[model samples]
Target: MVQRFTISLDAELAATLDGYMVKRGASNRSEAIRDLIRNALTLNHTDKSNNCVAVVSYVYDHHERQLGSRLIKHHHEHHDLAVSTLHVHIDHHHCLEMTVLRGPGEAVRRLAEATLAERGVQFGHVNLIPLKEHGGHHQHDDGANHVHQRPAL
Candidate 1:
């Protein structure tokens, strides 16, 4: 079901919204407004205990003392939260690492913070996506039970 409502925007704000819609390729005002609202809610609704999946990415000096070992230790410390990592050698001196993590929001954020705070780390960023777990377990045609998680939006 869809709910309909009326909103009033000033001329300046309405024009800006139209520009935004054009930049984002929104089909119409309603679509653009829906996307904006979803983004706002997602940003504000994530609490410490909320379940989330995050990607933490950064570039670091590969040869900086024991930076590599420390990075490994950080991941090991939060082994359960870490799903996978991709390492790319940017050059002889720098490497890029992107790690995917899933767990409680607080824990994921802490891990990303620690990793990004390391001495040699630079350009660190984390994208956290809140998730909602489907109620209980279900079985697919394969006869295996599993749980599903979808983006909170």
Candidate 2:
């Protein structure tokens, strides 16, 4: 069942939303508003611990003495949290790395911070998203569907 609640938008906010609706090719304001609300909910959910995946991006000087090894060790220390990592040779001196981590929000954020704080690292940022929760004690059932049933809006 859909519950109707009035949301009063000021003129400026309403105009900006209209522009977003046009640019994004949303069918109507209702759809756009629904999408925005869903996005907000997802972000809010992911911002909490125990339910987040993060992409941590940083730039560092690979030539820094032992920094590369230290970084590797750090990731290894949290091997359970890391999903994968992508490294790029941005230049002769600087390298760019993006590490994807899946774990509690705090742990992933800590890992990103520790890696970025190492000597010669710069531009570190972590973008996190909340995924489907898997906190139950269910065994691997190959045939059982595990889709979560969200409440009807």
- The per-model lDDT (C-alpha) reads 0.88, 0.78
- Alpha-carbon lDDT of model 2: 0.78
TM-score versus the correct structure, for each prediction: 0.76, 0.64
Best by lDDT: 1
Q: lDDT tens string, model 1, 6-108?
A: 9999999999999999999999999999999987876554588678888999999898999999999888888999989999999999999999998888888
Per-residue lDDT tens digits for candidate 2, residues 10-69, read 999999999999998999899889988877775455354455777889998888999889
Candidate 1 lDDT: 0.88
What would the TM-score be for candidate 1 when compared with the true structure? 0.76
What local lDDT does model 1 show for residue 56?
Answer: 92
* Clash-forming residue pairs, model 2: none
> Against the true structure, whose TM-score is highest?
1
RMSD of each: 3.4, 5.4
Pick out the ten consecutive residues of candidate 1 with the lowest summed lDDT: 144-153
